[model samples]
Every structure is written in structure tokens, then in C-alpha cells.
Target: MKDLYHPAEPSLFTGRESANRAYLHENIRTVDLRSESTPPTGKVPALFGYACDEGVRRNLGRPGAAEGPRAFRRGLGKLPWLQEAPDGLADAGDIRLDTDRLESAQQAFSEGIAQLLRSGYFPIGIGGGHDIAFAHYKGVRTYLPTGRKLGIVNFDAHFDLRSPGDAPHSGSPFFQIARTCEQEGFGFHYACIGVRRDANPQVLWDRAKELSVLTVAREELLGSALQASLKKLKTFLKRVDAVYLTIDLDGFSSAYAPGVSAASPMGYSPWEMMPLLDAVLGCGKLVSMDLAELNPAFDTDGQTAALAGSLVHRVLHYPGLF
Candidate 1:
């Protein structure tokens, strides 16, 4: 773990100074996960960075997401801390991918997440690729009590259940989680929102059906239909003891989130999705969360990163979670 981890870069957390206000950059503390120092005993939101996008490269998507964490921090840092939060925030640093060994890197990251959970900290993972979902689930499973059911709620344009033919990639994280659950004698409860009909194919849809995956299509959330969709989402939430929420930037319309591994011309807006997000977070079942695929290279004036940062901010401000 020490070899794979590095201290959080201090320079990324900088913003305008204010005498009576608190900004994220001003309050977030950088922790050296590799150090011998003891972990926090109180519940706090800890940010973990996965600095690899080999999965995106292998999945044949435009790859620049490896640098997502830095961009996300830059955008998040400037926002003032509005609500009452824990003493401050903690950054456990990044799991650097020095080689092409995505699997090994993910394993190390999962271990780190498990450590955070054991220390009573809520993990907020910033992604290198959508593939981090597998690692995130593994960590949560490791920390959760035995026999407790885990629910996965994903906001994505694609189902992400593609078969891992040669190896796993950004397109196969959920499928990987399903396989892992099956092998371990646990049920896979996954509910995917914002699925674009054109983004996925018949075979993937068939695979989702085979796995008994619950899906709410992009169109289902349009206009008045969102109420029905929310009810369906609430029903799904009742079936699990815990929830792991993941947001893929591409799930939003390209106009709102232009920097992602796969940008969709038509997708849901933040305004349309916040209600759903609030429902999930307020339900008191959310255990961990992540924001994935923010590619700064393609971002227009840092719009996508700011959006991702705002989501993170929302999580931090949610009173129920803290």
C-alpha cells in the first residue's frame, strides 16, 4: 500500500481568502495514508483519488481521466463551505498507477477504502475511470457486516455491463461486481438510472435482464415521468441495507458535462437529476459515493470539473450523511 500511495498534493487546494467564510480549499486536511499515524476515530468524509485510466484506454474511450482528481480538487476548493460540516475534510491522497496493472492498483485502492471505513470515515472516491466502481464495491463489501445486503445505485448513460472478454475495463465494472457477488454467495442488487437506449445494445440489455438488474431509462425521467421513476427508485432502495452511489459524468448531457470518456449529446440535466440524488442520500442508506470520468483535457473552461466538484460539495453538505 505504501508503494502505491502518495501524499495529497497541497497546491491543488487554493482559493480566494475570506475572513468570515470557510472554503473547501481552506478546510480540507491532507493525510498521508502511507504514514504510521493513526486514522481518525470520528466519522468524516475522506477523499480518495484513483489515479489510473488504463481501463478507459482498454475500453477504447478517449483517455485523460487519470488526471481527474486534480481537476476535481481545483474546482471543489473554491466553493465556500456553507453548511455545518465536520471539523474539516480529509484527503487520504491518491493511489498512483505507476504501471499498466489495473487489477493490482484496484486491489490496493480497495484495501485503502476498507481502512477508511474501519476508521469511521465515509469514503468519497474521485475516479480515474468508471472501472473504479469494482474496487469501490469490494472495499464496501469488505467493511460491511456479514449477511448485510448491498445496493448499487449508478447514474450512468450506459449500463456498463459489457463482458470482460480479455480483461476488465471501464465498460465492465458492474458486470465484475455481479460476478464477484455470485462467487461469494451474495445477491447483486443494482439499480441503474439515466440509461440511454442508444448508449447500450440489445446484448447488454439481455445481460442486465439475466442478472435481474433494475434499470430506469433516460426517457423515463423526462417531464412528469420522473415522479414514477422516483417511486420506483424508492422501492428499490427498500430492498437493501446499504447503498453505494456512483455518478458517471457522461450520464449528463454533453452540454452540461462536456468532459467525459464518452460524451452523450442528449442526456439528463443536473436540475433533473438532483431530486433523485437527494432521495438516495436522504434515505440514510448511502454508505459511500464516487464521481467518475471527469476528463479535464476535453473540458471546456473547466465546466465538467466544476459540476463534478459541486456534486461532491452536495454530498459534504448533506446533513444526514455527516
Candidate 2:
């Protein structure tokens, strides 16, 4: 495997080191997407994992998320399979962000996503914030011909359907996406999984119902295992041409993933969530994926990053098991 670290930083974490070499090496790939060079196109479909840490901690009006891509890369460096996989995987790197020009940054990110799709590559976006989902969805739209609907599988604790106002933050992605679909006359079928009743706002719930979106609450999902929920998801996927998967870390309980901005005390366990991912991959038309809301500041140990890294590895390696 190639060395993916900068000469200036040789240590992993905030100087903390672990012996999980597979976690650091096997399932990781890196790229600097900010470069002007175009991505190469080839036969076997390519998978580009993007780490965009632009708006990561913007709710606090601070910077540091720019390091998100590198941090995740370092964690992945310790994983071995990522390095050994024969699959066509590349790191598209992080989008450069100008703190003062957020809209421009978003446009750039959206364009990067579009380029990947046009080149016929599957994109797995990592971090920054849930807000990036809007741009990701927009990129997918470019690939769809007229009259095609896009299916979305959002696994998160919150609905993320907050009203989109002048400055749409991370919490307002779904609202923007729904609005876009309505205005453009593009059909969208969205299924929200792992929602906590207490976290969803009334307006969002009303909108979800009005749109005929299928929402599987946490209580209902916890009552059954991941396989059962996935069985239900397959029915939803059949209605659309392509699928986009978004995973907010908060969907997992605090015990399993405490490194998210909105940690939930009761959420899915790793054992439970893996099967859902497996089922989504089985759908065979996964266009793009986003894993968001990972706040390293809140992590006790490196457990959250390790778990996320493992989940990513599984999603990339295991295509389908229907």
C-alpha cells in the first residue's frame, strides 16, 4: 500500500496510537479531489470515497473540520484489506473550502460529485456535516434522464427536514432535497430508518407524511433485527431507478457511536446496522453514499472512528447477499 500521510504529520489521532493495523490499513483509500486533473474512466465501475470536512463543526462557528479527511485517512491507513483489495477504489480527496464563501464551496463540492457520477463511479462521501447531502443529491440528478425518480435511504436519529431558509445548515438538507424534487418535477421516494420519535419536529413529520415518505421509527426497528428492516427496504428500492444512502452516526446508540453531534442513548447497534447496509448494497443500483455527523471531539477513545472505518470496509467489500 502507498503511504498516504503528509510529511508534517506522522502520528494517528491526537497523538494516540492503537495496534489495530487492519483497521488502519485494509479498507482505506485517499485522493486530493481539489486538484484540477480529471478522474480517469475505465471498465469495472470505480468507487470514489470522498472525505469533505467543510461544515463539520460549523454549528459552533469554528474551523478544524478541514482535517476530517486526513483524520479518517489515517484511521483507514491502519486497515489492511483496503490496501489489498482488487476492486477499483480511489480517494477523491476533500473539497477545498473558503470559510467566507460557503456557497462557492458547496457548488464546488456539488460539481465534484457530478463529475464522479458522469464518469460512472460510485461515490461514498464522508463527514463535514449532514448538509452535504443536498449537494450529493443534486449530483445524482444530473445522471438521471427525465421522468426518473431517485430513491433515498436515510438512516439517522433526526429527520433532517428542518425548513430551508437563507442559510441552510446541516439540519436542513432533507428540506432542500424535498423542495428541489417538488420544484423540478422529479419524483423522489424517500425512506427514513432509525428515526427517534422525540427528535423529529412536528412540521417535518407532517411534511414527511404529506410527501408519502416511508419512515421506520427506532422503536419499530429495534423490535426486529437488521434483516427484517432490510426486507422492508427492498420493497422501497424497487420503485426507483437509482438509490442514494446517507448514514448519520447519531443513528447508532451512544454506547456504540458517541462521536456524533447528536448522540442518542437508544439507537441501533453495530450488529444490527451492518445487515441494513448489506441489504442496501444488494439493491444493485447504489449511486452514492454519505456517512456524516462524526464528531471526533466527543469520542472517548478511538472507538467511533474504528467502528465507522469497519462499517465502511464492509459496505465496500460486500456487494450483495440477498
Candidate 3:
């Protein structure tokens, strides 16, 4: 695992945006270049980034999410924390792909995460692409007890359940997961919020139904307003013992998050999205989580990365019931 990734730089943590204690660069732990330093004392959540975008290229999409980790770090570095504990933050650095070996990279990522969970740290991943979900799921699965079911709550516009071609891509994470769940005899309970009708085609829709996936279409996500969506999500969480929450920044409108690969003009706002996030954190079943698809190239004023970073801050600080 040593050469599989680069260690984080302490320089990335220095910024004078404010005098407040919200600056992540000052507070976060950086993995040393030589080897791992001792794990921070206490039950703190560990954070890491996936800095590869080969999944986007494999899917025939834009390139640049490889820079997501750096952008997210810059955005996150400026925030001020309110009543947060200092020892709770650790940055494990980014997972690097071994020269077109995305599968190996993913497995390394999974093992890294599994290690974090085994050591009593809540693991949160910032992904280069949505494909990280499959790896993230694998890490979560490694820690769960036998016979336990895992549920995923994804905030995205598409199902990401397309069947794989020669290998896995960003579009086929859930499909791969669903198939594996069947083989492993574990129930795949997914509740997706903010699915866009125009973004996904009919076959994907039918496939989603076939898998018995619970979807909250973009319109329905805001049908009775955000509180209703939060309530529905809360109800969905009751069906599983543990959870892995994924946020694809593309789920938000381009106006709010313009840096994503496939920006949507018609999507939820930060105002409309946070309540549901609050509810997800409130559910208390969260075992792992990921924030994906923050393409800084298309971003305006670092809004998308900053938003992802803000959400990352929230999730990391959440004192979960687990």
C-alpha cells in the first residue's frame, strides 16, 4: 500500500482565510511519505481521496476529475469549524491507479478503507469518479458481520447501474454491485434521491425497477418540498442495518455545481439539498460515505468543490450513533 499512493502535503493545509478554527489544513493529519505515522489517538474518522479519473475516460466522458482531490482540499481548507474536536481528523492522502490498472487501484482503495474500519475509524472517501462507489461498497462489506444487509443512499441524477462492458466504468457501479449482492446472497437495498428523467434512458429505468430500487425522481424529490424528501429518505433508512451514502455533485444544478462532468441545469439547490443530508446523518446507520465527481475544470469560483468540501466537513464532524 505504500507505493500505491502519495502522502499528503502539510503545505496544502496552510491558508489564512480566517482566524477561526475552521481551516482544515491546520487541523487535519497528513500521511507521511516514509510510511504511516501512528493512527491518531481515539476513535476519529479518517478521510482520503481517490485521485484518478480513468473511469470517466472509460465511460467516454470528460477528463479532469483526477484533480478533484486537490480542488476539494483547497475548498475545504477555508472552512471554520464550530465546536469540533481537533483529534477527529486524519487525511490518508489519495489512492493512485497503477498505470491503467483501475481494478487494482479500486481493490487497494477497498483494502485501505477496510483497514480504517477495522481500526475503529469512520472512513470517508472523496472520489475522482462515481465508480468509487463499488470500491467503497466493497470496503464497507468487508467489515460487516455475516448475514448483515448493506444499503446505499445515493444523491445523483442517474442510476449508475448500467451493465459493464469489458470491465467496470463509472456508469456500472450499482449494476456490478447488484449482481455481486445476488451472488453473495446479501440484499442490495438502494434509495436514490434526485434521479433525473432526462438523464437516464428507458432501459436503465426498467433495470432500476427490476432491481426493486427505490427512486426519488428529481421532481418528486422536491414534490412536496425538501422536508418531505427527507422524511422519505428517513423511512428508507429504516430498512437496513448499515449504510454507505454517496453524493455525486452532478446531482445538483449546474448553477450550483458547474464543475461536474455532466452538469445539469435543472437540479436541486444547496438550500434544497442540505435538509436531506441532515436527515441522512441523523439516521445514525452511516458506516461509510463518499463524495464524488467534483470536476474543478468546469467549476466557477470553486463552488462545486467548495460545496463538496463543506458537505465533507459536515459528514466528518457528525457524531454518529454507531
Candidate 4:
């Protein structure tokens, strides 16, 4: 059976040049417990994916999230080449998820990430929803057992800190991570950038303040220069050992990114937002990244996906201090 979601085509971005897959496959490796085989070996970074579309809505008998991984792969495949490198890169393929088992799905996703980290590979997750953040954090925590403090810089219109309940939805990831870290005696710092003033509740704001989270409101974001915001964010990240970046496409204005699960009228333009990411890349310790909420059904001309793909390229291509 041919896998519809095959590893990325080496020639897609490499053009007529000698493909990197042969070299990468020999050097990069994956331990397949199912087949009882040793992992592959390569220098190219492995792109591990989790296409989760399961959540409360799906659990309630709505559409399943099986399409997320494919949609994101489509976007990624369409990305333009930015820089040249000798290393080969390939998608490690999606982590299979059970829609009916949320906790189990989270555990599976987390373990996949832990495995990738252990192999010294960078993992770029494509979301089924923002709730995947919890799994990403879990992976980071599991891999970094040295007690290194980690910080999160989330770019979203919603705060995503809703109280824990029987069901975990996309709107409750940050809260779940925060609460989990608190219970486990870990230092987790959170900074919410590009937040919509009206989207968050008073209680959420009070909690953020109490936790000393650096909340940058949309109004403040629009008012101040991007350089200023970058400066402020850099200072915050400096206090932490490593950083995980989660960018929710809804943080971009509807005109800029109309494909998001929740589009907002007042948000940053693509040009306005890219610099912030550039600033984050400058920080040098960007451990992992997840770009979420891109609903292609609402997109026109594939612009949103293209924009997202470009950002992913930038994240991978950008030079760093590390």
C-alpha cells in the first residue's frame, strides 16, 4: 500500500541538483519499534508531524481531524526555496492519532516528540488545533530533564488559558500547560503576544498578571514599533534557558490570514508579523515551533497557506547566534 502522505520529495525544493534524500537517509535514522529495526541516520532535520483534528467538536460527532496533516503538508510543499544547504530534509511522516482517545493521542504525540529530540532532530509540528501545544510542551519537558527553565511565546488572538474541565479543547492548552508545570515544580514562563483586547476575560488577565506573564495587547502591538516589541520580547526570553514558539494564524488579520479557525478583523498584517518571527529567530534557542488554526476552506488563492509555508521556511532558514 502506497502511503498518500509520503516523505517530502527531495527535488521539490532542490530542483535539478543531486537530491539530498539518499545522503540523509543514510545519515538520519528512526527507531521503528513496530518493525524492530534500528533508526535511520542523516544530517537533515526530521520534520515530525501530528495532524490532529480530534477535539470536543469531533468527539460530539462532528468532522474528524484526519485532514489536518495533509492540508499542512500541502502548504509546506508549496513553500518557495529561500537558502541553499548541503543537508537533506524530509518529513518524518505524521504521528497517527485516535480521535476518540484525547489523552492517549496527547501521549502518543508527546512520545513521538521525545523520540525526535533524543535523536538530535528538530521537530516542526503541524497542528490539528492549538491544543497540540500541551503535547509539544510535554515532549519538551520529557526531553529536557536537566531542570532547565523554559519559556513560551505564543502569538494568538485568544489567551487559551481556560480552566481545566472534563474535555480539553483548542482554547485550553496554555492553561493546561501552566497548571501542569505548577504541579510538577517546573519553571514555565509564558508571554502572550498579539492578544485581542476583547477576546480574553478579566479572570484570565488577572491570572496572567499574577503569574507575571508578559501580555502584549494588540493595541499596544499596533501602537509601538515592531523593533520595540522585539526588544521587549528578547529581554523576556533572555531570562529563560530555551523557548518554544506557538504561532496561531488567527493572530494575523483576516485580510492577511483568512484561513484560520477563528479569524479576527483587527490583527497584524503579514509584513507586520514576519519581523516578530525574525526577532524570535534571533533569540537562538527556538526549540520547537507549531503554526496552528489554518483552515484552508476559508482561504482564497492559497495565500494563507503560502504565507504560513514561507514563515516555516524562514524559521528553518534564518541564521542564529547558536
Candidate 5:
């Protein structure tokens, strides 16, 4: 109900139209002060941007992910939709954080996300950093009925299980989340894919064991080994009721997604994970979803942004809409 977001800049594509009549630039119903306050029909999934990277800064990573929200929008807006984007598509502008109030900003994000859900819209968060995943989860946790299982599936390179110190940083969200789950007397069933063994220290791995977190390593997402992991993922998926799926762009190989807070040499191509995404959506348990860590500053040819956009397009059209 509050004006939690700054109206997103509508500066988008100026491309030639195709006969297919399927370009996002011509369609996405972007929310401004005037639009989001109105009740959503929920026929279309609500799209929004999280424009802050203070978490990345606190975690001592690169600084440009603050620009991630708009950059991703630019990439998403220009993609040829192949089919008309559904009429219900709503862009709820962006929640921008420009001050030192990261905690309060996260609260605002949580509230905004919750509002979307209550208004009958499925929320799609294009993020500023991976720490925003906590806020995303907060919204889902708040809106769902009590005692429902909340499963978090992160497509990332690190476990993100670092303990929060005097302040919470990007690396500390999952720790905070797991702790919250414990305090709330719920299962902390977190499954992480593409975790690079070398990227995390022994202590983090120990922490994972302590939390009983399910994981698949970077090596496992590759060639022949991936099949077994996919089966494992199926087993993993069967155990959780609803899911909050988050994608940290750094989860993809630097070749496929170089513009992230942390680039990875061993990351898998985004296409390789398509089946997993399909399976996750097919389970019909996906609640809130997010894409994080797209750093336009490091993006070489806009390829990462394009991939992020493509992934979103696929998500919006799941079950073969497009």
C-alpha cells in the first residue's frame, strides 16, 4: 500500500517490429505511481525490479549490481517475445535503495513482494544482488499460511551460508534465513545447485552439513554427470511443498554470463539448466522467483543481460505459452 518503489525508467527498445507481433517493448504493463496501487487481475505475472547492491558492497564484492534492475529490464524489454506477451503482465517499477538503511530497505522489498501476492499477482523479481533473496523469501514466508513448508532453491556458485556479524551482508542471508526457520519451528530445506567446491571454505561446507542442506556441485552440472544430479534433484523436489527459486547470475559460466558480481570459470551454460527450470516450474510449487547479480558494468556484449532476459521470458511463458 506504500509507495515503496521509484517509477522505473521506461526507456526501452526502438527496434523494428516483426510480423509475429511479439515484442516486450510494445507490451509489458509497467507500473508507476498510478498503476500498481490498483488491484491486479493476476492473469499475468507481476514483474518488478530490486535496485540496490548494498548487500554486495557489505559483502565486499563488486559495486555495479545496483544498476542490475534497470539493466535487466532493458535486456528483457527488447527481446522478441515470439508470441504476444500476456495482457496481464505488470511491471511494478523498482524498489531502489540509495541510503545506508539496508535492513529497512529489505523490509520495504518484503512488503512490496507481499503486496503483489495479496493483489493476486505472482511476483517476478529481477534483482540488484543475491542478498535480495532473503527479502524475497521474507515476502513469501509472510504471505503463506502458517506451518507450510518453505523450500529455497538457489542456483548459485556459493552456499551463501556465512554467519551474519554485527551487520548482515550478501553472504549472510541464508544463514539468517535458516536461523529464522529454526526459530519459527519449520524445516530449513535449502537446495543449492552449481556450488563450486573451491569457492567455499571448509567451514561453510561444515555449516551446510549442520543445516542438512541439499547440494550439487559445479562438476555435477556438467555433461554425463548431470543426469544423476537431475535425478537427485527430482528426489529433492518431492520433499518440499512450495519453492522460492533464486538465480544468482554468477551461477552460470563466465562464458555464458560474465557480468555478475562474481564470474565463474566453471559455470554451466544457462541452456543446460533449462530442463531443471522446467522441472521446477512443472512441480507447480514455485511461489516467488528472483534473478540476481547482473552487473552491467562487467557485461561484455550484453550477452548476460540477454540470457537473463531469455530466462525470464521462458519463465513467464512456462507450460508453453510462448
Candidate 6:
């Protein structure tokens, strides 16, 4: 466990530190989950970084997302803590990928996530790619009671249900998770928001249909169809014992989130996603969540990274969810 974990550093979280006002960095605590720590009396969110992009490379997308965790921290560092502060916000550090094998890294990440869940911490994963979803789902499912249905709510442009081919990649996480659930005699419930019709092939659509994956297309969330989309999301949310929320930056218009492995020109805006986010986070069913595919290589003036940071800030401050 120690070999896979790297402790968080204060240097990574740098902002205008002040005693008078509480900022995210000012109160964040660095923890080593490899060692047992006392469970917090109240809800505490623990941030863990999956610092590997081999999945992105394998998926034929851009690299450099391996640095995404650091960028996300730097992006979040200066944000003000508006919510009534908790005892501490935990940073469990990065699950570093020390080799070329992405599978091993993903397994290590799942183990770390399972540990956090067992410790009674709300795990928030900062990702190297959307592939982290498979590992994250595995971790959450492992921690939950057997036969409990795990619903996946993914805000992404692509279905990510593509077959793993020879090995799993960013595009194959959901399919991989579905397979895992099937092999283990559990259920796979998935709802994908912000799907782009142009982005997915017919085969992938067929796969979603076969899996009964509920999807809210990009166009539906653009105008009058948004409420209908929200209704669909709500219905999906009601069907599972717990939900795993993952935001692939590419789900948003390239204008809103340009620093991603995949960029969509016709994606929806962040403003359009607020109500949906509120619906999910307020449901109190979220077990774990993640932000994926924030590749610094394509980011312009750190805009996407900052947006990613702001999203996490919103999640932490969002009412009704721990």
C-alpha cells in the first residue's frame, strides 16, 4: 500500500493563506491512508489523485494528464471556503503509476478508494483519464454490500462503453465495469448526460441500448429539452442504492473546458449543468465522485483547470450532500 501511495505536500496547495478567512488550502489536511487514521466524527471529504495517463495514451488521445492531479490542486488552492467549515478536508495524496502497465495502476487506485470508503471518508478522485471510472466503481462496489445496485452517472460526451479490445482505455471503463458486475453477479446501472450524437458510433449506441444505459444527449440539455433530461436523470437516480458521479471535462463545450483528452465543439455549457448537479448531489446517494481528463497540455491560460477547481469547490460546498 505504501509503495502505491505518495503523501500530499503543502507545496501543492498554495494560495493566499490567511487566518482571518478560511480558504480550501488553509484547512486541508494531508493524510496517508496506508496507515489507519481515526474516523472523523462528521462527514469528511478525502481527495485522492490518480496520477497516470497511460489509459489516455492507449485510447489514442493526448497525454500529460498524468500531471492533472497537481494542476487540479493548484487550480483549487486559491478558492474560498464558503461553506461552514468541517473539522478538516482530507487529501490522501496521489496513487502514482510507477510503470507502463495501466491495469496495475488502476488496481492500486481501486484499493486506495476502497480503503477510504472503509474509513468512512467521502472519496473525491482527481483523475488521469476517464478510465479511472472503472477503478472507482470497482472500489465503491467492493465496499458496498453484495448485490447492492451501483448506478453510474457520467457527465461525458462519449459513452465510454467501447469494448476494451486488447486492453482497457479511457473509452472502455464503463464497459469494463459492466463486465465486472456481470461476472460478479451484480447489476450495472448507468446514465450518461451530455452525450454527443456525433461523437459516438452506432456500435457504441447499440452497446448502451443493450445495457439499458439511460442517456441525455447534448442537444437535449441545450434548450427546451433540459427539464425532460433532468427528469430522466432523476428517474435513473432512483433506481440504485448508491451513485458514482464522474465528470469528464470533455463533456462540456471546448469553450468551457478546453483542456481535455477529447474536445467537443457542440458540448453544453457549465451553466446548463448546475441544476443536474444539484439534483444528484442533493439526493444524498453519492458514494464517490471524480473529475477526469483535465490535460494541461491543451489548457489555455489554465482556464479549464480553474473550472475543474471551481466544480470541486461547488461539490464540497453543495448543500445536503456530505
lDDT of candidate 6 over 129-205, digit per residue (tens) = 88899999989988999867888999999999988999899999999988988898888899999899999999999
Summed over model 2, clashes come to 18
Instruction: Locate the minimum summed-lDDT window of 10 residues in model 5.
Output: 12-21
Q: Please give the CA lDDT of all the candidate structures.
A: 0.89, 0.65, 0.80, 0.67, 0.81, 0.88
What TM-score does model 5 achieve against the real structure?
A: 0.93
How do all the candidates rank in terms of TM-score, highest first? 6, 1, 5, 3, 4, 2
Which candidate, 3 or 6, would have the higher TM-score against the true structure?
6
Off by over 4 Å in 1: 36-41
Question: What tens-digit string does per-residue lDDT give for candidate 3 at 257-281?
Answer: 9998778899888767677778788
Model 2, CA-based lDDT: 0.65
lDDT of 5 by residue, 1-322 (tens): 2445776566753345666546776666666533546675544677778888888888888889888887887777766665435664677877888786778778888888888777777788987878888899889999999878888888899999999798887888899999988898878989898898878999999999999888888888778988988888878888888888998999899998889998877887787777676778777788778999999999999988988988888887676332
Candidate 5 global Cα RMSD: 2.2
Clashing pairs in 6: none
lDDT of 1 by residue, 154-259 (tens): 9999999998888899999999999999999999999999999899999999999999888899988889989999999999899899999999999999999999
Error of 6 at 77 (Å): 1.2
- Clashing residue pairs, backbone N/CA/C < 3 A, model 1: none
TM-score of each: 0.97, 0.81, 0.92, 0.83, 0.93, 0.97
User: What residue pairs are clashing in model 3?
Assistant: 13-25, 22-79, 22-80, 22-81
Per-residue accuracy of model 2 over 274-299 as CA lDDT, tens digit each: 66666777888787887776666676
Once fitted onto the true fold, the runs of candidate 6 whose alpha carbons sit more than 4 angstroms away are none
Clash pairs for candidate 5: none
Clashes of each: 0, 18, 4, 11, 0, 0
Top candidate on lDDT is 1
